[model samples]
Target chain A: MQIVVDLNRCQGYAQCAFLAPQVFELHGEEALMFTPAVPDDQRERVHRAAAACPVQAIVVGERAGPGVR
Target chain B: MQPDTLFQRITDYANRADPYPLYAELRENGVTRQDDGSYLVGTYHEIAALLHDPRISSDYRSRTHPDEAMIRRNERPPSFIGLDDPEHDRLRRIAMRPFGPPHSPGRIDELHGDITRIAEELIDAFRGADRIDIVDEFAYPLPVTVICRLLGVPHEDVPRIRAWTNAIIDSFDFTPGADQEKRQQAGLDARDAMARYLGELAGGRRGHPSEDMLSALVNDAGPEGRLTDVELMATATLLLIAGHETTVNLITNGVLTLLRHPDAHKRLRDEPGLMPRAVEELLRYEPPVHMLPQRTPLADIEVAGVTVPKGAPLILMLASGNRDPLRFDDPDRFDPEREDNQHFGFGSGIHNCFGAPLARLETQIALGALLPYLDDFHLLDDPPPYRRSPLLRGPRHLLIARG
Candidate 1:
């Protein structure tokens, strides 16, 4: 599954990173870096991370198409 | 029994120990409008959505009938917690710089050793003691000391700071009584005095540049520019208080809940790996801050099919939402291994608890250290004395005896 983070909306609360550290990593206080393509092993964690995002900044699956940044 | 007084009764000191049943009633009522012109939301989905809603303002000044005492006390501008973005986001970002990732990635993790050591020291003091008050001796001092060291404030100042914090917290009491004015004044006075004290401490850190948050904030010169003297004072005061207050409740509540559920306590002691998840459960089951008492709506918002007008006091019952049956399976049960636990313990959205990482580590260490002794622990008070403020809810003292 593909993932996209609306960086503008992401306040870097790091809930995503905390839940799915392999898929999402916070570079600094506010800069969040993530793996767009979810790995098989991390799919469950990514889903949990998406749900836990405070700002709902993370979009996953079919809705998270290209150019949605 | 008018439904409007639900919020009032919930805040009443009598229900302080266990407000869950009332919360269930509140969830059944949906979004309720109180007689005092405030709105109380207790449902899980509604509270979660409202937390993420931009229409919901955290600023108390936005209320139609803003507290005059609060207005006067906040003459120096409200802290970022009380401000809306882009202002809140800006100040919060600047403040986050020296404390967490990506600016200072290891800041909180680095404190793990210190936190463990501190927890051990506090527990060590309980040696040869037949009984102890966890709040005064263990829970309270642990977080306060950690926060002080992190902020570069001298540990000796805690007693004075504690007075200021107590007065400030007492001001948050929702009940209107004859002493309301006096309590508000004390809170305002405490805030001002605390601000002045914090400001002086930050001022001393300028150019000296110690390895502390206060010094980092004081010496900061990033692209976002510096927090003005007043802003610095407000921010410093916010950090100090926020860092100190809530975590105490988290730790104390953990102990209380553990003692109450001996089975869970035994499970934790046997399988210490569950400590982190247990902490999360404690947050959901018995959170520190029960309600967000000072939120306002920017526009007429439809919450749970109720049209809440703008400028109305919006009290989000966080602890209630934590126990909403619709949100969790067997919501009342304390399951350490519970998965997908996205709790309102630290709240959500932009105003989420800033000190969460540190608070979590501190609690884990604090409780993990106490696990060995909990087997012999006997609660001296089943329903321990709770603090006055319903917002930052927790026992004021948890008395226990060790066999």
Candidate 2:
């Protein structure tokens, strides 16, 4: 699975990072860094993170393409 | 049939103890337009969507009928919570720097030992006591001290600061009263006074940096530029109030719920690892904040098939959505181990509770510390007297006694 985070939309609530730290990391207050390609073991965590994103900035699965809403 | 009084009834002091029934009625009614011309959105999905929608404005000035009090408040700069982005975003980010990650990553975590120590100390004061008022002795003081220590405010000033906070919060009462104007003016006056006090406090730390948030904020020279004097005052006051006010309710409400559900309380005490999840459940089951009373729509937005006209007062029933059967399985049940618990306890979207990490840690430690003593604790008042504001609903005092 792949993930796409709309950095513009992300407010760095860090819900994603809290749920899936390995997949998503917040560098500073607002800068969010994430692993785009999810490991099989991390698939569940990534899905949870996406759903838990306060701004809905995280997109996962095959539909996770650049500039995709 | 008379006009729908669901919103009115929900805000009524009589229903303050449990507004869940009215909320269920609201969800059944979908997006409801009250006689007062405001709209109430109670369903889980709709409230969640509106919360995320930028079209929903948090600024009270956007209301269709901006009153004298609101205009008076306008004289002072709006805090980040009341402003829209990029202004809100900017102030919030600057405020976040000293509180949490990635900057000051250990800020909240560093408070763990202090929080535990504080909770234990508060509990220790309960020694040889047959009864306790959780709100007064335990819940209120713990967060107040933690926030004061974090903000660099002298602990001696808490009584004065709390007076200002009370006045400000009392101004938010939704129920129409004869002294509404008086209350509003007092709220504004209190805000100004509090801001002045906070400004002086922050001013003292301007050049010489200290360990507290106010010091960091006043001395900050990040790329975002420093907060103006007014901004610093507003931001500092916001942190101080937000740090303690809601947290007091969270701790009080958590203890109240646990005492009501002894089985859950026992389970929690038996397995302390469930403390975090139990806190989340407490947020969902009996959240500190019950509603967002000041939201306005920037545009005519269709919600649940009803179009909420622009500038109309939009009250989001967060606690209602937490119990919406459509959202959670057995929404009324207090299940600590429940998963997929994305609750509005801290709210969601851009204006989500900034002090959530600290609040969570505080509550968990508080409840964990008090769990052992709760085995013999019984509620002195089942539906305890609630606070005045329905928006920030919780018991004003939770009297518990040893069996």
Candidate 3:
């Protein structure tokens, strides 16, 4: 699975970091550092983080998860 | 049909405990223009969309003044929350530096130990009481102490701060025809006094730095940062008030909601891991903030098919959006495991609640620590007395007896 956060739109709410700390890390207040892709194990939380974003700044799919249509 | 009257009723102090039904009605009617010429939006998606829309303005400068003199007298340099970008974005960035990701990434996370300790201490203080006021005893003190410490304010100053907080909150009453002159004056006085004190405190940190957020604001520097004395005063007051005031309601409301619903309470007690999701549900089901009416439309805005003209107030009934059935299944039900709960308990978008992470942590810890005592507790006053402010809604005093 692939994950992306539009750094421009990201206001550093840290909802992503809270929900999926393994996949995303927030540096200071302005910088959001994250893994672009994650193994299937972290898929659920990453998706949850994407949906939880107040700005919808997170994008989660260049590659679909296994068995996901 | 009178759409604006519904807003009046919702803001009415009488309906504070259960304004959800009124909000449902607003959603049903679609976007409503109040008799005051402002607009009220209660639908979930619409509220969410408007919150993110850059066209909408949180700047108070945009509002059509009821009294030009009063607005001028009452207005101070707005904290970033009330400003539009790039100004809002700039101040928020500086404020966020010490509080959140990147530079101080682990700041709030590190407060876990301190906050948990505060919650535990507050709970332990409840050991010998037969009956207790949750607001005065448990919910209020925990956040007050945490915020005081966070801002480098002396804990002994809480009484003074509380007085100011009360006055400020009273000035913010949204009920129609509420007395304004005295309360607004008091609020301005309190704000001035608070700003002066915080300014002095921040000044001290300039040469001799401390570990608190105020210290960071004064001493810390970056390419995009540094707040002037006026900005610092406004920002400090905003943080101090914003940090504790809403959080007190959250903890108080969480306890009240849980005690009302024992099955859910028991579930939370049994599975402590569910605290995060449960806290989110508490926020959705019974949010601290029922309405934020300050956002004015910058231009003619169409919401749910109604046109809200420029310069009119746009009341975003955030609490209403939380219960909108379009947003959540079984919207009114307080399910601890409610998924995809992107609640407006904390306002959404750039203006989303900055203290959300801390607030969530406090509520989680607060509910976790208090759950044991609540296990053997019963409500002494059902539908407890609520505070007068409609913006921040919670029981004024939740009396509970351990039997």
Candidate 4:
């Protein structure tokens, strides 16, 4: 399983960046600076980073899901 | 005598501001039992263990649940936190669906803007005031409004519900010789009244869908289907109470703590990016939900060789765990940059805080926004007087002067 963040809804709390910076990246404005996807080897980091998102905008799986909006 | 016991004192008002010492005393051992037959567990490891134990029920309907007479007089089944599985599992699932898939990504990301907007509005109210009581002025309205908006509760009813919410929380105190009956009844009246109020509010959304949790619960067709009338009321009660009460304390504690610890306050102001970790540290150092609902030991439970007999009460001090020197270096130090901080601010295991993500976001935003503003402020008291309930710990009023 991998992680995917919908940039459209991301407000840049950077919680993902804080929890698993190895996989998730936070820009200066707090939005995703890089891709949220993680390799299978980094699934643990991806899962934790996903869990860390307060808005629950991070999706974890082989595929990305629809946006809340 | 265990110093953790709050049996002494001419007034129980001292409980609100800081229950940390009592927690420290309780942390000195496995568990201490009060004369009233209630127990207190302040050790983080022990609390974590009990929180994870299935036998330790959070539900009042459980065999070892708190007596109805012990709870507020007229409230229906207690909050979802005070509930056992099956029902707890059912309601928690529905309550959480719209929020997120438990540990999934942040779906509430869109609300960040709205939350910021709300925070700004509340701050607007604080602009000209010379002295601000954190409770009445800032912390209180922030979370209360957020919950109201989240649950779709009408803002007009907030005052009434807020009163009921206070009454319900007041009833949970375990202070010796305290009139539990009066507080409990007030809590009961608050619950029924709030339930009736929320029930009416939710009624209109039955056929009509709204973008709120209540609407989601009302229309939920998940594995458990929609919430029952009773369950719906209970869920609303939980959201309104849990949504604000715990968070308000957390936000207030964060501000008051900063005002007292000017250095930490300065560091946060200089480095606004650290607000996230600061929020975590604040949670550990001064958590909102101080003690959890009572837990009854099943059969015989042994912790580090001491056996807690069946039916014995156990209280888990999560905040104390955050300060445990065994787990954290200088556990009491309010360091926002403190690494490896796996504090139990939101409890842990299955019943961990469902709204933790939202709560964290709110605090980070509120604190991050307010840090610069509070930099010039000073605490009027070394330790401001606390609220009455040990369960919901925080200052009743924190006076800060920017001048």
Task: Show where candidate 4 strays beyond 4 Å.
Answer: A1-69, B1-12, B36-38, B61-68, B71-75, B102-106, B177-179
* Candidate 4 per-residue C-alpha lDDT over B252-349 given as tens digits, one digit per residue, 9 for 90 to 100: 88987887788888888887756776887787888887666466766677765667667665656667777777777888788878765667888776
RMSD of each: 5.1, 5.2, 4.0, 7.6
Q: Tens digit of lDDT per residue, candidate 1, span B199-311?
A: 99999888899899999998976778889999998998999999979999999999899998989999998988678778888889999999998899999999988999999
Per TM-score, the best of the predicted structures is 3
lDDT of 2 by residue, B1-403 (tens): 3224788788788889988988889899889888879898888999899988999999987888976667788788999999999999899888877876666665765676898898889888996699999999999999999999998999999899889999998887867779888888898999999999999989989899999999999897667888999999889888988899999999999998998888899999899867877888898899988998889999999998899999998989999999999989999999988877878898988889888877877888899899998888799999999888888878989998988
Candidate 2 residue B70 C-alpha distance from true site, Å:
2.3
The better-scoring model by DockQ among 1 and 4 is 1
Q: At residue B141, give the lDDT of candidate 1.
A: 97
Model 4 chain B is weakest, by summed lDDT over 10 consecutive residues, at: B2-11
Model 4 CA lDDT for position B104: 27
- Clashing residue pairs found in predicted model 3: A26-B102, A27-B101, A27-B102, A28-B101, A28-B102, A28-B103, A29-B101
What lDDT is reached at residue B5 by model 2? 79
Fnat values, candidates in order: 0.11, 0.11, 0.17, 0.02
Whichever of 1 and 4 has more lDDT, that candidate is: 1
lDDT order, best first, reads 1, 2, 3, 4
| Candidate 2 or 1, higher lDDT | 1
Question: How many clashing residue pairs, candidate 3?
Answer: 7
Model 3 lDDT vs. the true structure? 0.83
Q: Show model 2 residue runs off by greater than 4 Å.
A: A1-11, A15-25, A28-69, B1-4
Q: What is model 1's C-alpha RMSD?
A: 5.1
True lDDT of residue B277, candidate 2: 72
